[model samples]
Target: MNKHIVIVGGGYVGMYTALRLQRKLGKELRNRSVRITVIDPNSYMTYQPFLPEAAAGNLSPRHVVAPLRRVLPKATILNGMVTKVDHANKKVTFVPGEGEPREIPYDLIVMAAGSISRTLPIPGLTDIGIGFKTVGEAIALRNRVLHQLDVAESTDDVEVRRRALTFVVVGAGFAGVEALAELEDMAKDSTRYYRNIKPSDVRWVLVEATNRVLPEVGPEMGKWTLEQLRERGIEVKLDTRLESATGGHVVLSDGTEFDAETLVWTAGVKPSPVVTEGDLPLDERGRIKTTTQLTVAGTKDAFAAGDLAGVPDVTNPGQYCAPNAQHAVRQAKVLGDNIVRTLHGQQLVEYRHKYVGSVAGLGLHQGVANVYGVKLRGLAAWFMHRTYHLSRVPTLNRKVRVVADWTLALFFKRETVSLGEMEHPRDEFRAAVASNRR
Candidate 1:
């Protein structure tokens, strides 16, 4: 049988699962007996854990993403979105980067569409609130932060300076804390070049609706992390909600008000809404329901394992595995093996791995980690954070480039210039045209 398998995403699961299958089914693939096609909006798999470094100029944005075509040489890669999956018909409506949507048939499917940033309806948020989910957002925030500094330096108005220097980040999860910390580090380092702007002038604030940050590391570590943040002159507002941000004017649940030119929303994430567009069974959380063995519940030739799939945690009874990269990476291994097992008429292996704890970097040479009940803080944890992720980032090319970035950082200060034109390359050209016409 010329088996065609279409993977609905090229993220952590979709990419890794395809990689594993390519290894296990080499003969079958070479014989033209098995085929794999991976679809995604971008032609790459972004290693999100490195996004903070990318934003802070510690690593290049391109280094954090693995081009799908380069990594999956044996598989078909489509740059597009899967609008709908009619599993009953064994087909999915595929929309390319451009052009009309068309239905593609497949004998098997892997749902790994992943999650998206979960944002609330806060005023002025649509205009001012920036997200911290993608590499592009990271680059944009970096540029905007640096550009704000230039505006502050050029103007003598205290109010304008205050607005430009004040930065607010919502959500105290790993993303929020890391992003605020890394950007603050970059901004403070950038002050040496500005004769007027000092590191003391910049205000970094973190708001969390929940009472704690880094909950994945447990309460004690969470408390320690909070303490570390506060010690760095970073404001940590717990149990505080963002009431509004109209016109860059932030109003918090605790009645705190400020004009922050930069407001980053890293609040949380929900499973990709595309999950609802498919016929797969989903749990109450709107994630595809799958067995511990990584197969979709009550379905054959259909599989899912990622942030969008509700995989059971056999290690912890009555609980589903958390939506995280740690679990997603490991699940992909089992997911690929199970698919191969199914094709070979072998028994499917169940996925059951205990939680390995968590890690987060707080700027340079600072971090916190809780691994196997061993709590580490300061530089030790920072090293662990880098070591763990370096091993996790796909491909030797990316790993080498990341290491090169870190090596160069040791010998030189970060490049602090803001290329604001990256956001609008044609603005200057348009202005030139208007001038010529006049």
Candidate 2:
């Protein structure tokens, strides 16, 4: 019987691991010695770093994601969720779209389900706030922002216009900052096309509970970022918490209240709840507890990595690896190599990499980066951000397409058109069919 390897989640870890296995275990796979399978709800792996650019219309949403079938042809791809993992019995329950759950047995399992946006129990938050995690969310946000502009321009009511124009983004990390900066820039640029709307009329607010903005970057860069946002007419409220957002009425802990039509929540992320469903050992933060080798602690023939795994950080003692793309990508490589070694009765190597630095794109031709104790800002940093992420985006096809996009962007005007109808595409068809039947 062939040894089966089942991988959960098609994000960074799942895609890279499957790719590595295909390349490294080609002989084993062809000889029926081993087989690999990947399961994910989406058929594509989204390069989350480019979500801000996608939302700002710098790159097409389709280009930022890699289709699993195209990228990992050697591995069996399942478009579904791993609802349950019976590791003790070497069986996994998967639920595909429009079908009942089914079970499959595996010799080994790789848990890399990734993380989801962390949310709170605040009233009306679920109804109003949108996250900036997936490509769908990015596209939706772009359309929503443009729709808000349409509402502001077409309405004559002063209060309604104010609410429509006010955009609130809760979080000061890279996602929050980049999404706010890019969308704000796009909105500012879009003002020229509207006779009733001006750049000054739009209110962009960044509400961070922490004292600093970009904590990943040093304090100096964080302060500079705060100043830059302030200069760009963005309201930066630090050391303030969101009290409630009931009925689109925002109340902050600082005795402030306001009604806003748009609210983006990019605060943070927690490990996917699927991790808890299994019998794997987990840390206090609900991440799979793993050793330096990326193997699930206290488990046999099981491994975990990426945002869901709490792999010990050797470079930073007493801490686990940060949930970032850089670490996740590097960890996947090591995990794949180690898995192969273990199968061949060879020794395993620990996963360790020193902290490089941080980078953030503020807006068009503006950014901040700190690498190896050297700080860079403005156009230089922006170029560096694009170059670094572009190189890490995965697949030669995607790389070429992204570069093509940037090259064409220099010559053509930025596209501000929103295709929100794509989300509910079947609605029109269903309505037409219903009318015909009537």
Query: TM-scores, in order shown?
Result: 0.98, 0.98
lDDT of 1: 0.93
Model 1 regions lying over 4 Å from their true place: none
Alpha carbon deviation, residue 289, candidate 2 (Å): 0.9
lDDT of 1 at 343: 87
How well is each residue in 1-438 modelled by candidate 2, as lDDT tens digits?
A: 468999999999999998888889999999979999999999999999999999999999889999999999889999988888888998899999868899989998999999999998888897679999999999999999998898898999999999999999999999999999999999999999999999999999899999999999899999999999999999999999888898899999898899998899999999988898878888988899899998999988899999999989999899889999999999889989988987888899999999899999998899999988989999999999999998899999999999999889899989877677888989999999999999
TM-score: model 1 vs. ground truth? 0.98
Worst lDDT 10-window in candidate 2: 415-424
Predicted model with the maximum TM-score: 1
Task: State the lDDT of candidate 1 residue by residue for 1-438, as single tens digits.
Answer: 689999999999999999999999999999989999999999999999999999999999999999999999999999898989899999999999889999999999999999999888788887678999899999999999999999999998999999999999999988998999899999999999999998899899999999999998889989999998888799999999999999989999999999999999988899998899978899998889999999999988999998899998999989999888999999999999999998888999999888888999999999999999999999999999999999999999999999999999999989998998989999999999999999
Candidate with best lDDT:
1
Q: Quantify all predictions' global Cα lDDT against the true fold.
A: 0.93, 0.92
Q: Model 1: how large is the Cα RMSD against the reference?
A: 0.9
